[model samples]
Target: MTNEQLQIRVEQISHDFFKKPFIHKAYFNNRLRTTGGRYVLKTHNIEFNPKHYEMYGLDELDGIIKHELCHYHLHIGGRGYKHADADFKNLLRTVGGSRYCRSVKPEPVRTPARYMMLCQNCGMKYMRKRRMDTSKYVCGRCKGPLKLYKMEEANGTQG
Candidate 1:
């Protein structure tokens, strides 16, 4: 939804749940990466991760809005508003807001091994992402001399 729609929704939820009006702005923040929403302590504004609504739908967005509203209302009322605060926890639980947001992105992919170390004596191989000095290291299994080879070279591929 658009920022204007989000602002209206946040305001409505605030009034419905907290019996308090959210005077500050509430908007979607695309740059928010790890959080569903955040309440700005200084500005009393709430920023939501648009990905939450796009990925999980309105139910999740409502939960996030309620969660942020808990902080907003408590802070505005001069009460404890942090996650660890009892007031915040009670308000959040009362509103049935989500304790935590679900992950919206996948785990990062690991880069392929770029180098390989082979033991001359035991034929054991170890993969590494960086080149190691062969002369300084020995095989763990047989204490044999180790040789480092580029993965592309070992695979017979030209880089």
Candidate 2:
């Protein structure tokens, strides 16, 4: 939804659920990666992640709006507004807000090791995803010289 619709929705939810009028702005913040929404303490504005609405629909978006409104109302009323506070928790529960937002994306995959280093004296092995200089580095165990080898060569694979 657009910022205007979001502002209207937030204001409506605040009035309907908290019995308070939300005077500040509410908008979608595309830069938000991990949070569903945030209540700005300084500006009293609320920012939402558009991805949440796109992925989970209006029900989830309403839950997020409710969660942020809890912070907004409590902070304005000069009460504890943090998640750990009793007032915030109680308000959130009363409004049936979500405690945590669902993940939007999966964890990134790790790249395979492309290079291996062997210590001549201590027999220590090290794996790395990128090439490193062997002339300046030494083994931690024995201060031995390190020999860099391609991972395929170390694995006995000729290419």
Candidate 3:
């Protein structure tokens, strides 16, 4: 969604759920790599990771907003606002906000070497992510000539 839409949603959620108005800005921040969202204590602005919305949709987005809102409201009230604080916990539970921001880390995939040149003599296998020139490289295990093999899919599973 656009920043305008996010701002409107944040305002609506603050009013509807928190019984307060959110006068600050709420916008998508592509630079947020790990966090689902964050509340700026200095500016009172809320930034959301666009990837979270893209992957998890509005329901997850709303939960993140709720999490950030807990921080926003508590900080504004001059009460305990840190994650470990009593006021923050109480308010979060009362509002049914997410206990933590949800951002899933991507799993790394290991691909078997597709370009292999076997020592025509020594039966050695070569694995590599990139296609290696058989004429230029040899199998380190046996210093045998390498042979290109069929490419296989790596276990690139999502987290």
Candidate 4:
């Protein structure tokens, strides 16, 4: 939908649920990648992610609007508006708003260990992603001499 539609819907939601008038503008922000909606502190504007509406439909869009409205109303009234604030949480629960604005990003992939340190006396092993000076660090288990070995993952072997 257009920015005008977004503005109208946001205003309606603000009025119906929040019992407050949102004097600021609301728009569809294409640049919003992570959040479904955001309330700008400086401009008092609410920006909605068009992708969220396209993927999740009107119910989700309404929830996003309600969530932002909570921020807008609380901030305008000089009340606690942050996620961790009691006022924000209570108002959000009263209005049945979304707990989170959007989904979280996926966790990054883990890289395999590149180097390992082994103790000469006790045969204790240590794994590391980066190369380190084995001479400087002693084995924790037996305080023995430590030797660094490169991990060979292709053949599933460790030296």
Q: Scored by Cα lDDT, where does model 1 land?
A: 0.92
Give each model a TM-score.
Answer: 0.81, 0.75, 0.69, 0.70
Q: Number of clashes in every candidate structure?
A: 0, 0, 9, 0
Check candidate 2 and list the clashing pairs: none
In angstroms, how far off is 62's CA in candidate 1?
1.2
Runs in model 1 lying further than 4 Å from the true structure:
120-125, 140-144, 149-159
Candidate 4 residue-wise lDDT, 14-129, digit = tens: 88988778899999888888999889999999898888888778889998899999999999999999999999999999999888755635578999898878898998888899
Candidate 3 lDDT, tens digit per residue, 1-159?
999999999999999999999989999999999899999999999999999899989998998899899999999999999999999998888878888666567888876465534465677655566766688876677777766654543223211
Better of 2 and 4 by TM-score: 2
Provide the overall lDDT of each model, using Cα atoms, as 2-decimal numbers: 0.92, 0.93, 0.83, 0.87
> In angstroms, how far off is 141's CA in candidate 1?
6.7
TM-score of 2: 0.75
Consecutive 10-residue window with the lowest summed lDDT within model 3: 150-159
lDDT of 2 by residue, 75-143 (tens): 999999999999999999999999999989868898999999999998899999999999999998999
**How far off is residue 9 in model 1, in Å?**
0.8
Between prediction 2 and prediction 3, the one with superior TM-score is 2
Per residue, candidate 1 scores C-alpha lDDT tens digits across 27-100 of 98899999999999889899999998999999999999999999888888899999999999999999999999
In candidate 1, position 100 carries an lDDT of 97
The Cα RMSD of model 4 versus the native structure comes to: 3.5
TM-score: the better of candidates 1 and 3: 1
Best of the candidates, TM-score: 1
**Ten contiguous residues minimizing lDDT sum, candidate 2:** 150-159
